[model samples]
Target: MALLELEGVTRRFGALVALDQVAMAVEEGEVRAVIGPNGAGKTTLFNVITGTVKPSAGTIRFAGESIGGQPSHHVCRLGLSRTFQITALFPEMSARENARLAAQARHARRWQPFGGAGVFRQAAALADAALEQLGLTSIGDTPAGLLSHGDQRLLEVAMAMAQQPRVLLLDEPTQGLSVEETAQAVDTLARFLQASRMTVLLVEHDMEVVFRLAHRITVLHRGAVIADSTPDAVKADPAVQDAYLGGFA
Candidate 1:
């Protein structure tokens, strides 16, 4: 079975249909990109998958089990993790500390009367490993708010990686980055995914990044899927061209 699957997923906010019968399947270790025009429901889809928003109809399956309507924390614990479009980090915390917190969330025992030093140490080690992998080890001591915007974005990704997830959901990861920063972010993310063999569902506006890293692309229009195909096929599709890519090209 595909690692992640959504069957006829629909989400509505009263009169507004944010998503309409959206169906998608992300296979193991594949990087799938979701793209569409503004208000096409890309973020809404992520919200539903990550359980920030519940679908009004249809089911979501991860690793062969149903997970639709599960709480965000529960879904996260089940090995699906997400990073938001806006970087979410503890501004006052150091990069290492932020990463350590995420790592601890995966392994810490809630029953512990007092936070154990051993657990903290283990989480710190994991944080260091993730930081090293992302080439952020040198800046691990820097405050998150003090880091450059691109570095902060990369740090947010490291925090997600620290979760030890089976699938990662990224929303506009390279948004607001400069040309050089965007290129760096894409290269760094691509290397990490390839090295770790991680499955990813990404929402992004940068067509270059999407074309560079995605194994396939799914296009959405007015809350419905318009195309799902390989990068080359998607680029050549007339419907996709007319809906979004024509202006992009």
Candidate 2:
């Protein structure tokens, strides 16, 4: 079975339809990129899959279990984790601390009055590992708010990775980054993904990043899928060209 599947999913904000009967499947170990112009429902799709927003209709299954409309925290515990388009972090907390909290969330006993020392130790190890993977080990002690914008973006990703999710959802992971920073982040992420082979569903505006990391591309336009195929195929798709990739391809 596919690791993540969405069938006939729809979401509406009042009278405005944000997503319309969307359907797609992401296989285990696959890196799928969801791309589109602004207002095309890419973010809405992520919100729905992550359980941040309840779908107005249709079903979402992850690892063969229905997840549609489940709470975000519940979905996260089921092995789905995501980073937001806007960098979400505890600005006052050190990078390591931020990651550690995410790691702790995965532990069943994390909310206990006295979770054993072992739980804390494991969470710490995972946090440090995620920071190292993102090349942020040197700045692990820096406050997230004090870090550069690029560093904050990478830190958010590290925090999500610390959750050790089976399916990672990244929403514009490289937003607001310089060309150099973007390249560095992409290279680090690429290396980590190669080593982990984690399943990923990405929503990104940067076509370069999308093409480089995605095994398959699913294009959206006006709240519906316009094209879903290999990167090259999607790029060449006539509908995609007219609707979204007019000049990017």
Candidate 3:
């Protein structure tokens, strides 16, 4: 069975239709890239899957059970997690601390504001492991807000990884990064996903990054899925070429 599946998903924002009858499936331990031009409803798709945006119609299934109506926290508890387009972290806290907080939250513990930030057992170990995996061990002790933009993005990944999620959702993981930094982030992501055998659904505009890391690619246009195929197939698809690549070039 697929790790995640969306069937005829639809979401309307009053007068505007953000997503329309979208259907796709992502297998476990594979990277599925969702791509398209601006206003193609990529972010809206992420929000729907994460439970931040409710779908007006259709079913969302994860690991065989229905999750279409579940709230965000409930979805996370089911081992689904995501990072944002904007860096989302505790600005003043060290990277380790930020990850630790996520670990605690994922483990169903309430956030505590007292005592030594250094001794949080389960969360501490998970955070450390995630930092090491992301090659962020060197800056684990530094405040998240102070890292270079690329490092900040890495820290966000670490936080999501700390959740030990079954399915990872990355909303433009390399957004706002330099060319070199974007490549670094993609390399790190590819390595992390490979090592963990985690399923990934990423919304990205960078074709290089998407084609390099995604096992399959799905194209959305005007809030609907117009094409879904392997990287090479997607690149050659006349519909995809006409809707996106034609203009991307």
lDDT of each: 0.90, 0.91, 0.89
| Model 2 whole-model lDDT (C-alpha atoms) | 0.91
Query: Which of candidates 2 and 3 reaches a greater TM-score?
Result: 2
- lDDT, residue 207, candidate 1: 97
Query: What tens-digit string does per-residue lDDT give for candidate 2 at 69-111?
Result: 9999889988999999988899999999999999888665544
Compared with the true structure, what per-residue lDDT tens digits does model 3 show for residues 74-164? 8887899899987789889999999998887777544344435543777899999999989999999999999998889888988998998
Residue 5 in model 2: shift from native, Å? 0.5
The residue pairs that clash in candidate 2, if any, are none
**After superposition, which runs of candidate 3 have C-alpha atoms over 4 Å from their true positions?**
109-119, 247-249
RMSD of 2: 1.5
* Deviation of model 1 at 247, angstroms: 4.8
In candidate 1, what are the lDDT values of residues 135-213, reduced to their tens digit? 8999999999999888888898888888878998899999889999998888888888889888999999999999988
lDDT of 1 at 243: 96
Rank list by lDDT: 2, 1, 3
Model 3 poorest 10 in a row by lDDT:
110-119
- Each candidate's number of clashing pairs is 0, 0, 0
lDDT of 3 at 196: 79
